[model samples]
Every structure is written in C-alpha cells, then in structure tokens.
Target: MSFVGKKYKLDKSENFDEYMKELGVGLVTRKMGNSLSPTVEVTLEGDTYTLTTTSTFKTSAISFKLGVEFDEETLDGRNVKSIITLDGNKLTQEQKGDKPTTIVREFTDNELITTLTIGNVKCVRVYKAV
Candidate 1:
C-alpha cells in the first residue's frame, strides 16, 4: 500500500525541544509544541500531496508537488521556501531560510518516523497509525 491516505498519531519524540531551540522558536511556542501530540494525515491526488498536521494548539495543512518550490509558514512561524521529494516510502522536505532545515518522513511498519535536522541538532519523532 502507498504511504498516502493514512492518519498517524504522534507516539514519541526525542530531542524535540533542543531542535526547536536551534530553530529559534520562542519559549512559549516551543513549550506548547513539545507538549502537544499531533496527528498527521497525508493524501495524494495525482501529482499533488496534501499534508495536514493537527494538534490541540493548531492545525496546519500544506499541499505541494514533488520537487516544486512553494512558500510555507512553518509551525514555529517561520516563512520558508520549501521543496519536497519522494524516495521510495520516504518524503524529504528541505526548507530554506535564515537557518535551512531538512525534514524526512519514512513510512514503514505501520509507523511514520520523522527526522528533523537543523544545523547540528537533530530530532526524531515517531508516529503510529491511528
């Protein structure tokens, strides 16, 4: 089955606070981000993919095509130029701004493993199918 059309709930996270700090997220937003468990839903329509991240604090959605650059407002409130690419069951997103970042989501074993990299700090967030 394709990795699309599945809903996943956040199970656990590692080093997320430190990663957020590296991204220059404010204390309040970082605290709320660390405490919130979000559900992510991915949907595919032709060449476009829609990703929705829902949490108690906020819900954000973005739709984009692979390899195409788009303007995106990140959860930490940074406006970035982003591009996403798909390799096998993994989706890698590169966000360009003052501090460039890469986010990779790998789908396997009914779980979604997300790795966030900013400078030398890295965070891993695991989500299980819900």
Candidate 2:
C-alpha cells in the first residue's frame, strides 16, 4: 500500500468554503479554491513523502516524513508546523499555528477522501482515482 504514483482527481467537496474561511482564507482565494477541481498525487523519495495538489489556478506541494515535524506554508499562505502519521489506511496530519487544523486522508478501493477540520467546522473532499 505504498500509494506512490497514484493520482486522484477531485470529485466532490462538502463545506470547503467554511473550512477555508475557518483557516482565515480571504474571499477571493476561497472563491478561487471552490471554482476549480484539483488533482492530488502522492509520491515518495527515500523516506520522504510528497503530496502535491494541482489545479488550473495554482499548484501547491508539501513534502514530509512520517512522524517528523516540518515547517509548512499552506495554500492559504500560513506558516505552520505540520506532522503526518499513518494509521491503517489513513494518513493523518495535524497542523499547529495561528489557526490550527487537522487533515485526514483515508484510502479506499476506488476513492481517496480528505477530511479537513477546525473547531466545529469539518469539510470533506472526495477524490476518485484517475
């Protein structure tokens, strides 16, 4: 279950606007974020895992190792410390900074679902393998 080389295309999104708003993303960025469907891919080099997100608007990437904390600049332009870990079929990440959030990516046979949560707001985005 290396997940390397697998590509998934965004198929559905729920409450994404609220999640972005919770992360302090401005209206224009949020709107741009909502308008496009991004393709996400996971790749590995040595012990480092890189998750890349690409859309017509912008492309973003984050590379990290399991259980190791790294400085991350989020798509919303926040500098946060993030660490990721794997549990069964899910890869979970906890980000700490001005607006803390948790992101979980669960893998299944046909789809990959990413859940982003902060406080009382939770957003789910589903990606189908492509």
Best by lDDT: 1
Model 1: residues with Cα > 4 Å off, grouped in runs: none
lDDT of predicted model 2: 0.92
- Superposed by TM-score, candidate 2 places the C-alpha of residue 31 at a distance from the truth, in angstroms, of 1.1
Question: Residues 6-41, candidate 1, lDDT per residue (tens digit)?
Answer: 999999999999999998888998888999999999
Cα RMSD (angstroms) for every candidate in the order listed? 0.9, 0.9
Model 2, runs deviating above 4 Å = none
Error of 1 at 126 (Å): 0.3
lDDT (0-100) at residue 14 of candidate 1?
Answer: 99
Q: In model 2, how large is the Cα lDDT of residue 87?
A: 92
lDDT for residue 60 in candidate 2, whole number 0-100: 95
| Candidate with the greatest TM-score versus the true structure | 1
lDDT of 2 at 89: 76
Kindly provide the TM-score of model 1 when superposed on the true structure, using C-alpha atoms.
0.97
lDDT of 1 at 39: 98
